[model samples]
Every structure is written in structure tokens, then in C-alpha cells.
Target: MDNRTNLDDYLAELGISEADESVTPPPMPDASDSAPVQEAADTDARGTLERFLRGLIARIDPELSVTVREVDDALEAEISGENAARLAGRDGRTLGAIEVIAYTVLSKQEGRGDTRVRVDIGGFRKRQADTLSKLAERLAIGVAKSGEPHELQPMPAAERRVIHIALKEHPDVMSESVGEGASRRLVIKPRHG
Candidate 1:
């Protein structure tokens, strides 16, 4: 919520009478407000998530019903079949974009710089993660057995990070991030060298 909106709600919750309202409401903070200004902000993740979903659904596709939540250390978003395909995007890239936007908006609304909101669109991300993890495992094994470092194709940072972390604890194999931006990937090799 914006500062003005927040300040307004605070005044309302205090039950300011019409006679007392003339005394002037609290001045809303300006853009120059510092980090401590977050103290007055609303951190209600569920309520905010609900409002965001309603507004997003209204703008995106009114026919589609979207259920959104910030739960289990991730943002879980589900949309009805009416717009699932449209939201799913090409192999879920669009879904990834939606997650990014939701995380950002939620973070801003929550006044937190570090947020772990996970957005799932029609469970596409979950299923995709499983598939990518398997693929990474298979590639890692093949590269390790070949005695040659292998560079997998480019993938989103989230997917690549998953692969990197999964291979991090392996005694016989290791992973490194390479390339730039979305083009980045993982290079897996035998841990000995």
C-alpha cells in the first residue's frame, strides 16, 4: 500500500470522529522517507496477496480465477483453466515473469528488500523444476563419466541455481555458473580436477 493510503487507514482504524477529523489527519510521508518509515507500513501478506490477485485477475482475464498465497517460503499462484495456458507462457517463461513481478510487488508492499515469495502458475513451475532437476542430474552424471567438463545450455538463473545447489554437495562432481544474464548456465565437472 502507498504511504498516503496506509496513513489514511491508520486514521480510520483509530475511529476518528467527523468532529475530530477536522483537526487534521497525520501527514503522509513523502518519498524522502527513510527505511524506518516501514514501521508504519502494512505487512499483511495474505490480504495484500488477495488484493493483488483480484486486481491482476481483473486486468489480465476476468474469466480466470487466480488463487495466490505467500506460503511455504514461496509464492503459490494458481489460475483456473480459462487462462492457465495464457499464463503458462512458452514452456513457462511467462510464468516465471509473473513470479518475478509478484515477488517484486509483494516485496515493495511488505517494505522488505529480501523476500522469498514463490509464485506457481498452474503448478507449472513445480513440474518444471522436477523435470529440470532430473535433466541436470543426468547431464552431470554423463559429464562426470566422460572425464570432460560439460556446459549445459542456458537457463533462467532460478533453474541454474537449483542445478548448482543440487550438485554442490556431490563429492565426485561440482558445478559453476557461467555466461551472462538469462543466458547463464552451469558447468559440471569431476570434482578431482
Candidate 2:
């Protein structure tokens, strides 16, 4: 007598017969395919992210377009369209969300590591950075003139980073972050003589 465990026999042992609809067997692996499918999937993270962002933009508005490129270890995506500002939202929260979603999806792919994706719409991020830099310089100058420390409204880590960088080489003022979590902000103080 032959002793073999077939699909029906195994399912029968587990009290699930061949007629059970919920106990279907999984699809068999493709024997002819020898490539590293998992690695292949992650090898084109930038391209995948570009496609994903474009699809997302399509859902928001079909007229929107996104251009993505690899900048060192990060992906920079620039979006242009009539509804681009809608993606930017107030203080770029919407754009940030899109980046987070893209990164999440990319990182979840097999073999991904330390993903960085930046999303910008119509150069809004550049304009915001420039405005923040100018504000940081103005605050630093004011602090130096009055010999008093000035505190800026709480901002996201990225904005605070811009402030610190903008004032890092200032002649008469220094910048630092204070507080915790969402309450964290930038403080400009007169440099000690």
C-alpha cells in the first residue's frame, strides 16, 4: 500500500473536505522563474514610487503630473498641475502626508532600507524654505540688536532645521531648538561675547 499525503487527504485530516470553499490551496510557485523576484521588486524603488505618486495625483486630478528623480539616497518628486496647491495644503501637511505614504509603501517592499522621499508641488517647498530662512535671519538680527533671546512659533522638524541652518553662521546670534514633540520651536539668542 502506498502512503502519501495529498491535498484532499491533508484537508480531510483537518476536518476540511475538498468541497470546503474556505480551504482552498495556495497557488503553486512558478518553477520556470529563477530570478530574485523580491530583490527585483525593490530594485526599482524610485520608478515604483514615481508610478505610485502619479497614480495618486491622478486620483486627485487627472491633469496633475509628477516628475521623480533619485537625488543621492533620496527621491525628489516635483508635481505640477492646476490642483498642485491642493496637495500642498496648509504648511505643506498634505504634501508631507504624500511623502510619508510613498516612503511607507517603498519601505514595505522586500529588501528596502532607509528610504527617503521628498514631495514638492509647484516649487512651494523651495519658496517656503526661502521664507523661513529669511525669517530666521530677521529674528537673529533682532535678537542681536536687542541683546534678547527671541522664540519662534513651534514648527515641524524640517522647518526648525532650516532655521538652524540659516542662522548657523550668523555673526551675532545662535539658534537652537527647545521644548518637546509638537511644542518644539526655534530660539534665536545673542551670541555670547
Candidate 3:
């Protein structure tokens, strides 16, 4: 009886294959250099973020890779490999949770002000933003043409911000958020003539 768990088989069951390049190649770490790597990570925000994301990824698949980079005022972490989508969850709830936790911990350690943290799995955030922007544009157009208010499905605060930003400069429509908590929605209204 073979008891060894095959990661490839498990990944395949999860709809991932060995041929997928989302998984990053592990670095060839020297036996003597591992401790220094850990030490160095504690000294920098970038390294700290990488370590945090790697820790989260390890919980799902020990072999999956996480990369963190400083992007503008935020620390962007990318999780690659088979289990990325699972970590991202439906509508990116899981990913958002992870980012919030990481950001909270990081802020506590370094003191909070600016520099937000974002997590992305397979460009999910970027794709979501693009989708939201396009939807906002279409809804704004509808509101402008019909002079009727267009209400979008309830979404998270971050998503609402995307819609607001997208329609902020529209000449014929204005975007606003209504409702509370999870039920909060984006509404586009025809600008008063």
C-alpha cells in the first residue's frame, strides 16, 4: 500500500496541471544561507510581506510560490500555482481577507499610515477592476440616455470605489453608493440638466 501523497495528482484534482507555469521555481538555497534569509526578511517591509504571503500559501500547498513587490503606495503580493484560485475564493473574498490580515499585522509592527497591501492571484484583481470599470461605463451610458437611475448589485467597498472612480468624471451621470454593509450598491443617476 502506497501512502505517499502525490502533489501533482492532488493539483490535477483541483484543476491544476504540472504544465501550468503559475508555480514559481523554488530558489536554490544554500544550507548555510537559510538562516540569513530569515533574518533579512525581518528587517524590511518587502521581505516581511513575502514571508507573510508565503506562510499563507504554505497552508494550502507547501510548494506554491508567493512573490511580493512594492507598487506605488501599496505592497502587492502575487500567489502563483495550482491553488491560487482557491486562495482567491469566490469574488476574491478570501484574497481580500488575506490582504487585510497581512496589512493589519504589518501595520501593527511598523505603525500604520499609508502604504496599503494588495494580494493578487493570476491577475484576478486587475481583471475584476477592468470588469467593474466597463460595467460602470455601460451603466452610466444607460442612465444618461434614459434619464433613469441605474442600480448595480451590492458589492464590497473596494469594488464600489472602482465604480465611483470610473463614473466620477462622466458629464451626464453621477455615481453614488447606497445601502449598508454587504448590501451596499452603486447607483448611477442622470446628472440634472
State how far residue 36 of model 3 sits from its true place (Å).
22
lDDT of 2 by residue, 1-193 (tens): 2122133443356585543343333332344655586534334666567766765665457698888887777778899988688779887888888778678656654235586788899788999999999898778878989999998888888899988999988989998999999999988999997
Span of 10 residues, lowest total lDDT, candidate 2: 1-10
Highest TM-score: give the candidate number. Answer: 2
Q: Can you write out model 3's per-residue Cα lDDT over 55-170, one digit (the tens) per residue?
A: 45664687678888776777788888875666688978788877886786566544543658888887788899999899888888788889999888998888999989998888
lDDT at position 66, candidate 2? 86
Residues 1-193, model 1: lDDT tens digits: 4432232343355584222322233233354545453333333554455456545555456686767655555556676655567677898777766666666656666654465656666667778778877877887788878979988888777788788777878777888988888788788888885
User: lDDT of each prediction vs. the true structure?
Assistant: 0.64, 0.73, 0.71
Stretches of candidate 3 above 4 Å error?
A: 1-43, 178-184
Q: In model 3, what are the clashing residue pairs, if there are any?
A: none
Clash number for candidate 3: 0
Order of quality (lDDT)? 2, 3, 1
Candidate 2 versus the native: TM-score?
0.73
